[model samples]
Target: VTFLCLPPVSFLLLPHALALWACTRSCPSRCTCTQEKSCSVLCDRINMADLPKEFPCEASSINLDKNNLKFLSERAFGTLPSLKSLSLDHNNISFITPGAFKGLPNLVELKMAHNEYIRYLHTRTFTSLKRLVRLDLSDCNLFSMPDRIFIEQTALKELLCFQNNFRRVPGAIRGMENLTHVYLERNRIEAVAYNSLLGLTSLKYLNLQENRINVIHDEAFKDLQQLENFYLNDNLLAELPKQAFKGLSRLKMLNLGGNLLTNVSKTWFSDLVELEVLYLDRNQLCFIEEGAFENLTSLITLHLNSNNLTALPFSVFQPIYFIGRLYLFRNPWECDCSLEWLKEWMENYKLVRDIPCASPSSVAGLDLSEVVYARLNGTCVDPAELNLTTALPDNPTTENKFNILISKLLQQELKEDLVNSTESFRNGTLLDPAESQVSGGYNGFSTGRALLVLLSMYLIQAETGPH
Candidate 1:
C-alpha cells in the first residue's frame, strides 16, 4: 500500500459533503410515497401542521387529509402544474388566501370537506382553478358563499356544498354555464326565491333537502328547464301555492317528504308531466284535491306514508296509468264505503301492501286492502251514489261558513274534554263514590260513563300518534 495522506482542508470538507447527502435523502418525511413509474403522494393522518416543502415534483394526486392545517396560503401547493386531484379534508382550516390553488392548472377534483372552521370565504380564493370539475366543500359550517367564488370555472361540472349554514342558494354559481350537479342539502336555507336558480339551464341534479325552507315561489325553478331530479324533502314547508313547481317540465324525481304540508291542492303536480318517482311521506297532509296528480302520467313510484290523510279521491290518481309502486301505510285512513273504488284500483298493482285503517273501531287496525267486501256485514253505498267530489271554493257560501264555524266549535269541545279528563286523572280528583241519586246535588252521570268518554279521547291521540 502506498502512503497517501490527504490535506487538512479535505477532512473539514468531507463532513460538509456528507451533510448534503443526508438532506437530499430526507425529503419523504411525514408522508408515504407510492408510485411505480408515475408521480403521486398520499400524506394522510400524519398530523401535518403545514404542507411538505419537498413534495413529489410531477405528482398528479395529493391526499393530505386528517391533518391539523389551520390555513392554506397562496403558495401551499408549489408550482405543480401536473396536479389533478387534491384532498385536504378533516383539517381545521379557517381561511384560504387568494390564488391558493394558482399553481395547479390541471387540477380536476378538489375536496376540502369536514373543515368546520372554514365558514367565511373570499370571492377570488378559487378563481384560479379554471379547469376544475368537481369541488366538495361539505360540512364546512359556512353561512354564505362569496360573490364570485366560482367565477370563470367553465369546465366545472359538480359543486357540493352540503351540511353548512347557508341561508339560501349561493348566487355566485349562476354564472357557471356547464355545471350539471349542485348539492346544497342539510343547510339552513329559509326559502326558494324567484330567479334563485336562474341561468342554470344545464343543471340536471339539484338537491336542497333537509333545510329550513318554509316557502317556494311558483317561479323559483322557472330557469331549470333541463333539471331532472329535484330533492326538497325534510324541510319546513307548511303550504305551497298552485303551480309552485313551474318550468321544470323535464323533472323526473321530486322529493317533498318530511314537511308540514296539510293539503295537496289541484294543479299541485300539474307542471311535472314527466315526473316518475314522487315522495310525499312524513307530512301532516289531510286533504288532496281531485286531479292533483292528473298530470303525473309517467309516475312510477309514489310514497304517501307517515301522514295524516283520511281519504284520497280516486280522481287524484286516475291519470297515473302505469304506477309501479304505491305506499299508503301509516296514515289515518277512513275505511268506509268511500274506499270501495280504492279496493279495485289497489288490486291492479301487485306491490301494494295491506293498508291499515285508523277509524271505525270495528275495523280500526285491520288491513283495509284485505277486507273481503263481499263477506262484510256492513252495507256499502253504490259506487255511483258515493260522490267523492269535495268542492273547495275560494268564496264559500254563508251555509259553508256556518258549517266551518260549527266544525271548529266541535273540535274545541273535544279538546276541552280531553284536557279535563287528563287533569282529573293527574290530580286524582276522579269520582270514586258509590253514590245514590235523589239528593240535593246528585253526582252527574255514573262512573262508567266518565270512564267511557276518557277512553275514547285517549284513543284519538293514540290513533293520530305523535308528530
Candidate 2:
C-alpha cells in the first residue's frame, strides 16, 4: 500500500514549489516576501515605472521614496489590495490618474509632501481613502485647489496643505464634518469666501497664517460650533469684515498680528464670549475704538504693540474683566490730556505694571501701576508747543529726524528692558529701581535737539531775511 501512493498528488506538489520560487526571485534586489499565513512585500525605492503585477502584497506596507516616478496609472495602486500605509514622499511624481486612491480603502496615513511637480489634485482622486485620517500634501506646489478635493474624504480629521501657492482659498472644503485640524498657512490667498467654510461643524484648530488675505467675509465662519484656535497673522488685511468672526462660539485664541489695520472698534470683538488670547501687534492701527473689546470678557492677553496709535480711549479697558497682561508699547502714544482715560484705567487695573514702551520718550518710564491717574494728568503732560503743524516745516522735519535717530539709538535699550523684565519677575522685583532711569536721558536729548534746531532756524532766517 505504501508503494502504491497516488501519483496525482505527487505531481501537483512540483508546480506549487516552482510557483513559490518564482515569486521569491522576481525582484530579489528590491523586494522581500515572507509567507506567514499571508504573504507581505517590503520595497524601499524600487524606482519602477509601475508596480510589479505579480507582487503578492496581501498584508503589507510599501515605502517608495526618493524615486523618479512621474505618473500613477488608474489601476497601478489598486493592485496593492492590502497596503495599509503608503509613503511616496520626496518623489518626482507629477501626475496621478483619476481615482488614484480608489483601491486604498484601508489606508490610514498618506504622505505626498515634497512632490513639487504635483500642482492640482482631481476631485475624486482621494475618494477611495474613506478610512484615511492624516493626509499631508504640504509643499506640493499646488497653485489652485479644486472645490471637491475633499468631497469624499469624510473620515479625514487632519489635512495639511501648508506652503502651497494658492492665490485664493478654493471653493472646495465646504463639507468635512469630522475634520478637526486644517493647516493652510503660508499661501497666497487674498480673499476668503463665505461659502468656502459653510459646513465644517467639527473644526477646532485652523491656521491661515502667512497669506496675502485682504478680506474675510462676515458669514465665512458661521457654523463652526467647536472651533478653538484660529490664526490669521502675517497678511495684508487693512480691515476685518466687521462681523468676520461671528459664529466661532468656542474660539479661545485668535492671532491677527502683522496686518495693515489702522483702527478697530470695541464692538469688533463683542460676540466672542469665549475668546482668551488676541494678538494685534505690528499693524498700522492709530486707535482702538472705545468699546472695541468690551465683549471679550474672557480675554487674558491682549497685544497692541508696534502700531501708530496716538491715544487710547477712556473706556478701552472697562469691559475686560480678567486681563493677565496688556501690551501697549511701541506705538506713538502721546503722553497728553487725551491719554487720561488710559491712565485712569491702568491705575484701577492691577495688571497695568508690565506695559513698557519701545521708546523711553514715548512712555516716560512711568510704571502705570504705581503712578496714580490723577497725578499723571499733571506730570506727563506734553506742552502745546510740541503739537505738530505743517507751518513748522524746519521744526517738524528736524523733530522727525531727531526721533528717527534716537529711535535707532534706543533699539537695544528696549530689548534690555524686556530682558530685565524676565529677570525681575523671577527675583520678586517685577519692577526694579532701574526703571526710573527710563526718563531724562532720552527725553532731554530729544527736547534739546528740537530747541537747538528752532534757534538755528531763527538765526538762519535773520541772516537770509524774508523770502
User: What number of backbone clashes does candidate 2 have, counting pairs of residues 3 or more apart or in separate chains?
Assistant: 6
Q: TM-scores across all candidates?
A: 0.74, 0.67
Cα TM-score of candidate 2: 0.67
lDDT of 2 by residue, 1-467 (tens): 24243234455575554434434554335667654434445665667555555554454556666667788778666555666667778888888888776777788888888899999788767767878888888889999878877776788898888999988766666778898998899988888888767778999999999999988887788877789999999999998877778767689999999999988866567678898999999999987777788888899999988889766756775677688888877776555555656656677765554443222243455443333221211353332221121112233344454453344334434445565552323255333233533533433233334554566676557557899
lDDT of each: 0.76, 0.69
RMSD from true fold, candidate 2 = 15.5
What ranges in model 2 sit over 4 Å off? 1-61, 78-82, 336-467
Among residues 3 or more apart in sequence or in different chains, the pairs in candidate 1 whose N, CA or C atoms overlap within 3 Å are none
Candidate 2 Cα deviation (angstroms), residue 317: 1.1
